[model samples]
Target: MEGAPQGTGYVVNLDEKLGRIDEHWKPRVVAQMNDYQFKLVKICGDFVWHSHADTDETFFVIDGEVRIDLRGGPVVIRAGELFVVPKGVEHKPYAEHEASIMLIEPCGVLNTGDARNERTAQNDMWL
Candidate 1:
């Protein structure tokens, strides 16, 4: 995102970008830093329980709210809040209504983490 081509700009209007998505649980990359990628995703219902084996996953709630059910207890994140699931910590996220979120993780990291299946989203899908 920093190395824009000549006259290109790095600033992205989040509202405009988020409007382009029509599916749940699918993340579209918006920016990059080093080997990490920042993605925008809209989620609803429940997500698969999984864990990242090698890197921590950061979640920033942009709108609505989400309940992250961890092995111990649930961590609810509302809009304007952020949470980080440590590496290898098994957890599942749920939302009663649609929630807009931004994920900061290593490039190519799978959304379903170690539990790869039909629900595993395609990685590095840029918006």
Candidate 2:
């Protein structure tokens, strides 16, 4: 209600969109600009270690905390914090508890980047 879109252009409520997500590791599209898309996902446990060769990946934490394991060290991102993993840099995302996050990246970028496995999620899922 409070964050619901008004009678105008698209106005997304991140909380409202996040409430619809029922699974971990699956990202659902919420908004798109130019050739990029804004995605929301709930994460827990560990994600695959991977990298995007053609584009950078952005992670914005909305709730709880996230730890990104990079070669240099682990970067912790709390709610309201954002981090960008540069293109071709391998990283892994992990959360001890469930965390809501937004990912900003170009369309067609796989969730697992170049690594494909049981952890790889379908592309272009919208909420």
Please name the candidate that would achieve the greatest lDDT relative to the true structure.
2
- Candidates' lDDT values, in order? 0.90, 0.92
**What lDDT does model 2 reach?**
0.92
lDDT tens readout by residue for model 1, 20-115: 889999998887888888899999999999999999999999999999999999999999999999999999999999999999999889999999
Model 1 residue 71 lDDT? Answer: 97
Find the 10 residues in a row with the least total lDDT in model 2: 1-10
Candidate 1: the clashing residue pairs are none
> Which stretches in model 1 have alpha-carbon errors above 4 Å?
1-9
Candidate 2 lDDT, 88-116, residue by residue in tens: 99999999999999999998999999999
Per-candidate RMSD, Å: 3.3, 4.0
Q: What local lDDT score does residue 8 receive in model 1, on the 0 to 100 scale?
A: 29
Error of 2 at 53 (Å): 0.2
